[model samples]
Target: MNYNGLFTHKLDALKEQGSYRHFLEVNKSAQHFPNFYYTNEEGVKRSAINWCSNDYLCMSTHEDVIAKLSFVSHRSGTGSSGTRNISGTTIYHRELENTLSNWHKKEAALLFNGAYQANTTTLKTLGKHIDNLVFISDECNHASIIEGIKSSGNEKRIFKHNDLIHLEEILQGINIDQPKIIVFESVYSMMGTIAPIKKIVALAKKYNALTYVDEVHAVGLYGNSGAGIVEQEHLEQEIDIVNGTLSKAIGVFGGYIAASNILIDFIRSFGTGFIFTTSLPPAVCAAATKSIQLIQRDDSLRKKFHENVLLLRKRMEENALPFSVNDSHITRIHIGNATQCKQLADDLLKIQGVYLQPINFPTVPIGNECLRIIVTSRHEPKHINHLVFSLKKLIYGDDTHNREIFSALSVADVENEA
Candidate 1:
């Protein structure tokens, strides 16, 4: 039936559209982070500065985090070996969940393979059991949340990104007694915009709707205790479901949902994504727990992380770089062309020894492709300056076309569109 030809045809189309995914192969020595060894196209291995790592505090590579991980691996070994219903639940698992619950001020917490699974499983389970359950989501919500809502096979409405008026309009149309959930991310990862949680919460209260917030990118980076945007906004108890990933700011591997005891139990009992799947490795969970503990114990890392964010933002502005206008750690340089986006990323890595993955279609719309530069506590000022210098050399020096496209994306208009 020429199945191979059919598969190739679709992949070929993606390549032509410059939307095909490409992964960078590199490894970072734990002690020396934001700097990693990557082989260039010429096969010569060179040290490169990392600009897009989700490890905001560099906790994953922290000596203490690694120490705990090693200690736990020696004590309990790796892999949980079974799903939670069977034998996967360990002391590490229980403690991490407990820590997460307390950190978010929720009555209970349930672990999932990743935040992706946590969202999909919980929403799908709720929809399956509740009658006339509908999901009202933000237009710019992460793919995981959207997939979760759609997988539930329930009616869904998407309000424009951060458009409280539109969200309220949708809520007003729904029956007062209907079971409704407003699903959104606390931090829109692409544009680095924050949701108006207070406004959203007020709307939810008025409409008798529950709030489900995905705090994957916010956890371990925001709030007094690093509980994420909800905690930062003092809306911890108000959010019905708070899904977070240990893989991001916590600098570990896994995801969990913090919620009321009844909701947690309900999802744990009926969520296929959580039930049948094997749990996270005990060592990883232990490491994640340790990382969070470290974060809560001190604000030094968070302070330094914000300092870097400010430095990067100031440099981008001083240089008149075309970037999204948002006061967040995420520094997005709007390039607006998929082909040029990939080319710019390629050039930066090959010519400048800086790694910033090209965020393209699906991750961001085609014309909205950008270089989502993320700053961490580990990034030095020299690295930041060099990154700006290299970007200027490639984007403004010789590439007139690149400059024109970026010039059109004025900071005001870019922020408005996003």
Candidate 2:
């Protein structure tokens, strides 16, 4: 058979599994809120209320951030021109790193082009230093962490999601003398559930292992000054390394790892991802620095963010939508089957103007297809009502076919109030 035919066959398989992804072209610019305009394949333009973006605090289109971008572009130019070890180490980059380190209360911080590169490079570099390194990771960690651990070519073990007993059992079973790293995210993106971070950090200490916490989804959105989950829980000093991203809540592009000065220096000396790639643009660095300062000073934003999350959760509960348990603003509406989930998402977009992307395998497990509705700070009560009304119509319709699942609303209510 021709190779072209085989490639087509693979594409067909993806279609059959409801896993094929197509990019939607945005005709208009993104707003400060969770809505944007897009042009469809039919060349028709439409406004869509987006519930799939990770812009939790809706800072991406803030006037201040945009103005800072403009100011930085005019002053320092665009690209960093080289790697950080080379010509990329501009004054803007240094200032941004310093700001981040101060925010997280870490001794130092180093920047990366993106969070994926940051996690992968940091894990790989740190893993190489220890002999017989054992990595204990959550089974539901993001793809970046999974790839990083696998690339390290070290012995690894995975525990059930948020199962502290399982994790401790594995830790106890492993040889205590060998170096280990307990890797996990502060917030599990897909499930919207927060890890038992303080407990995990304690376990790491008991095992004499280093802790690596990924705060990509939590940073610049949690704590008093948006320092992330560690700060929210007041466990900043307990975590060994904290990985974060500027592209999310900071509304800019780039990633960074905050740790002891020695660890940051170690990664700088050996991490191939940092040593090889061009540094973030000078404008991007400046934008991030400004955004960080804004987040630190803006307590009202965090309060509004939490209020929006509570409002959305309450509405979803009232509508009797099936959802996972979560403490954060991220909410996953479980649609069960893959095809139905995709159809539901498409219906929400085309019929109701809601643009929630269907998350299917392998982002989730084979049977755990869901519509991950990310509620941002900018979403108002009217938006929450609109989502609830549309979802209720689609899920319940005239008949009560989903009564069993609808009964789960009480659980969501309790969880939300908790």
Candidate 3:
């Protein structure tokens, strides 16, 4: 058995299946967000409007977040220096944890390097520690949750995405005396569909199972204070643990779990992923704290982001371009074939200056390939119009301009009325 041959075979299989990932190099400017510079295959620098960035609220480059980051970096130097137990815990970390706990209305919060770390560690730890822990997970949950559940060697059952009946059936089948946990996500990122948090919480209560809700995508875009869908539905208290990321909506690079003090302390003490890993930098924690503070104080950013989503949806509808329909801000255009998905993304970048990275298999199921479009607060009406027009022409071969689509609408006009 040749190790080199085995590795080559896997690479060949991926390439042949059109599932190989090629990351695009993009540099976004603080001055002109939503517009970025990317190098083409020929090494030519091209400008494009970003359509797939996870910087949902455009807070990554916000002045307030930048100021906090710069100040924290200056004061603390660079890295956290070691793992949390060693010399990593700082005033900023404690402050950020406090901010998170307050936001989620939880008893305490624990920081991890990222959402993947938090979810994986928390789930595995709970499964390992609890007696006869049974995991009931949503079928469409992100890889992080599934991996965490699997790694724990727990008895797991997967319910259909957002299918409460299926979930209830599984819950009913489990013994009432057995310890169990329900794992799901607030927002299914790839398809842009939201989970039914209230009903799920109710079921968890009836079955006496712990509930873990991953709100990575919803944290900065939903609810009164951008706490997440749980907050929006007034179910924050129902969830036993809430896992969130600072990378996506918060525009920083970290993740955290909000829960009761004992649960958090238990994870901190027992979870290998938490204990072995270096903590996130002080600057990242500070920036995330500032981002949360600013977002909580002002609902304007979330409103503006939704307005952009509406504008994009309206344009796509007017153009008759096929895309996934959901109330969430995500816009997913179907491209069933993987090769076609890749080609479509390349064509959009090279021809129309629209940069949306193609999402393919393992991230999403094969034959369900699609282009995920994330419209941010920084995207104007013109950008939305142009993106719709370009997508129509490239995908549907509808190049004819429909003046009615633009319709003299601007984000500023919408904001002014608000």
Candidate 4:
């Protein structure tokens, strides 16, 4: 049997398809954020502006967060050493869970290694234990949610993205007696569109289905206290489970689920992903807890982030650059072709010193390949204008084919699709 030949052939196929991924190694200096050093294709180290970081508030570099991490690490050493059930759980983890539960106004919270594990394990556990369990999911739900639902080996239906009517139709056909769950993400990461949280929760109530909302993208950036979309919509009480990640806006590393005490206790007891994995380090948990506390008290960070979002959008519009026009902070420039998407990103990084990772297939639909730019509070007006200028020149340059593709997309249509 030529096992090596089979493996090589598949990898070769991916490279031939222009879908092969190559990660750009970067060293983000503590002194300068949004600006980092990366080696170009020619092996020359260069500085570039970051536009793809999920650290929305720049809290990952915040002094308070760093202080907590330093203090906890110095006091407790490094690793958590084992799964939570064994010796991993600590006061840091417990306190963080308490903070998270209170922030979301939930009865309890259970920490997971990360949001990926939380979603994957919790959904799988729920589907397995609940009789006649079925999952109704958003078409564009994050890969984690999709994976968890798939692992459950239960009946599942995917409705059109953000189409409440489609979701309701699917729900109505299911036998009312069967246990069901509606799983979705609060913010559609790729498109920057917010889910219809209130409407979806209302439907879940009408259909008597459990509601699970992954608020990974919305958690540190929305609501008065940064709870999430559910909080913003006043539907926090309506959502059965809310999943969030600390690695993003919270600007640390970990994930947790906020829910009723009974539901949380059930998942905590049975979720294999949580049960089997080593818990997050005490220092990381402590830092995350501090970050959350700081963010909840201050709106300046999110306000500054939104200002940057608006500035970038306005700059792109003024230049007539093609990008997804959504109300959310995510700025997606549609490039359509995978090769072109990578090329644009490479050129921006190497030549213009603008760094935004290209969004390609399986992260997004093939024809929808684009640059998912994330503007943070650190990006100034000059940086935004420079990005827009570089993008305009590169995209609208002598490449008539690329120009035609960009011209064909109506910004209005993009917004409507969102």
Candidate 5:
């Protein structure tokens, strides 16, 4: 067969397996919330209530943040034009780092373009310092960490998801004197489950290992002043390095690692991700600074966001929708097969005007297909009601719970059908 024919055959296989993805064009007015009206192929405008975005706090289009962005853009132009080690280190970059260090209660902070680079650089760089660097990572850690660990050429031990006993057992098996790093996330992005940070920190102490926490999802959304899981659990002192991002909660784009001054200095001098990449533009840094200030000064937004989460979760539970048990703003509704998950998302969008992108492998495992719904403070009660109604219609063909143990359906079951 011809090479093109073979490639086409592979594409057809993906479609048959329910893994082929297509992008939908949106051409309409934008809004503050993820939900917006978009023009379809026929130039027809339709309203879509988006549930797939990572904008947890709905600060992306805030007036204050936008104003700062505008002001900084006027002053600093469009881009940084050079790497941070060269000319990209602007006053805005310095200010953002200082603000972040203060927010997380760390001695120093270093900024990266995003969390992916932050994790990759930190993990890979740390691997070089220790004689024998051992990584104990959670099985469900983000792909960024996975790639970082892989590149480091270090011996990695993956613990079962949220299983303290397994994690402890692995630590116990490792040589106590070897330099070890326990890498994990405060709040997992896909699963929406929070790590047992306190317990993990305790284990780190017992094993004399460094605790590197990726608070990408939890930062600017948890704690009294949006410090993240370490602050929320009062384990800030215990955690050695706290990695976070400004894109999600702070309503901007960038990533940072907060730690002791010595550690920050070491990474700053050696980490290629930071040294080679151009620093974030002055406008983004300004917007992030303003956003952090807002999150710190105002507690009402956090409260409202939490309440919205509770309301949405309650509605889902009342409707007998299949979901995970982890407590956070992320509410994942499990739909067994990848095809069914995509179909459900598509049907809800077209029929009910509710929009959620279907999460399939390898973002998730093969069988654990889900529709991850993120609720924000800006979402009204009616939005939750519509989501519940649409989900009920799609999942059960009616609002009836005749299926047994919706949570028990394994990834294998879905994959087998596919």
Candidate 6:
């Protein structure tokens, strides 16, 4: 078999369709971020401003967080050196889990290696253990959720994104006594849209279904204590399960699911992903615990984060850029075509030192390609202004030149609340 030829053919197809992913090697500078050093495809180290970082509050570089991480790593060894059941459960892990459960106002919490694993393993365990379990998920759910539900070999129903009416119709078809879970996200990162969580919760109650909300993008960035959207919207007691990531907004590394003690125990005991995989290192748990404490005590970081978000949206609006608004800390500058989206990103990185990755299929549907920007608290007005100015020059061309890198965008193709 010409195995290499087959692999190359498939990879070439990805490049042809512009769906191939090329990772940029970057080193973020604590003193000057948004501005970072990145090694390009040509192996040249270049400076660039990042507008797509998931470090919402920049807590990863916090002095106290770093101190705790270093302290733990020095006291303990570097690695856990075992799975959770085999000498991997340290005091740091227990402390972090306890802190998380209290923060989410849940009876218990179970730690996972990553948020993706948390979702996939938790859902898989629930589906496999519960007889006749059904998952009614949002169509726009992350790939991890889709993979888990599909892997369970259970019946899966997908409703249109945030469409309560369609969701209810699907629920009505299922038996009232049937065990079902409504899986969705608190914030759609790519489009900067907030879900109708309250309405979805109501539907779940009416249908006697469990609710699972992925708070990966919302935790440490919402609520008074940085609990997440449930706490922010006063739905903490209503949500059955909340899966969150320490890596994103928390600015650490790990994932957890907050739930009732019974459900938590069940997953921890039976989940293959949790039972067999190695646990998080002591330093990571310590750093995450410290970061969570910081977020709870400080609101200035979150305020600055929202301020930067508003500044960015305002700048884009002033320049008549085609972008969508969901009153969140994300800006989705719509370019429509995948090829054009990649071109815009490349031009911005190469010519203006601005960096943002393009969102394309199958991450998003065709014709919905765009550049998703996530501004952190560290980003200032100058960075926002630079980004807008660079985007305008590349997308709209300067007065001296007639360079048109993108086609004319139609009102229908663009989704703007400007």
Model 3 lDDT-worst window of ten: 400-409
Q: What order do candidates take by TM-score, descending?
A: 1, 4, 6, 3, 2, 5
Q: Roughly what TM-score does model 2 have, to 2 decimal places?
A: 0.94
TM-score of each: 0.98, 0.94, 0.94, 0.97, 0.92, 0.96
Model 5 spans with C-alpha error above 4 angstroms: 1-13, 26-34, 41-43, 398-418
The count of backbone overlaps in candidate 1 is 0
User: Residue by residue across 1-418, what tens digits does model 3's lDDT show?
Assistant: 8999999999999999889999888887978989999888898889999998899898899999999999989999879988999999999999999999999999999999999999999999999999799999999999999999999999999999899999999999999989999999999898788999899989999999999999999998999999999999998788999999999889989999999999999999999999998888999999999999999999999999998898888888787675677768778776666877888888888889999998999899887777899999999999998998888777656552322232343433322321
Worst 10-residue lDDT window, candidate 6: 399-408
Kindly report which residue stretches of model 6 are placed more than 4 angstroms away from their true locations once superposed. Answer: 41-43, 398-407, 410-413, 416-418
Pairs that clash in candidate 3: none
lDDT string for model 1 (1-418, tens) is 9999999999999899899998889788787788999776688889989999999999988899999999999999878899997999999999999999999999999999898888888888888888889999998888888888888899999999999999999999999999999988888899899999999999999999999999998998899998888988899878899999999899999899999999999998899999999999999999999999999999899999999999988897788776777756788887777899998898888888989999999898778888999999999999899999988888787654556566566677766665
Per-candidate Cα lDDT values, in order, are 0.89, 0.85, 0.89, 0.89, 0.85, 0.89
lDDT of 2 by residue, 1-418 (tens): 6999999999999899988886766543555356678876687888878777776776777888889999989988878789887898998999999998999999999999999999999998877777789999999899999998989889999999889999999999988898999999998888778999999988998989899999999998889888999999999889999999999888899999999999999999999999999999999998889888989998788788888888887787776675776787778777657777787777778878888888898888877777888877777888889998888876777653443443444554534522
**Clash list (residue pairs), candidate 5:** 367-411
In each prediction, how many residue pairs overlap at the backbone (N, C-alpha, C within less than 3 A)? 0, 0, 0, 0, 1, 0
What digit string (tens of lDDT, one per residue) describes model 5 on residues 1-418? 4999999998998898798887766432226365688776677888788776667777787789989999999988979988987889999999999999999999999999998999999999998776699999999999999998988899999999889999999999999998899999999878888899989988999998999999999988899898887899888788999999999888899999999999999999999888988889989998999999999999888888899999988887787775776677777766758877787777788888888888887788987778889887788899999999887776667442323324465534433432
Q: Root-mean-square deviation of each candidate, in angstroms?
A: 1.2, 2.7, 5.7, 1.4, 3.6, 1.9
Report the candidate with higher TM-score, 1 versus 3.
1
lDDT for position 99 in model 5: 97
Whole-structure CA lDDT of model 3: 0.89
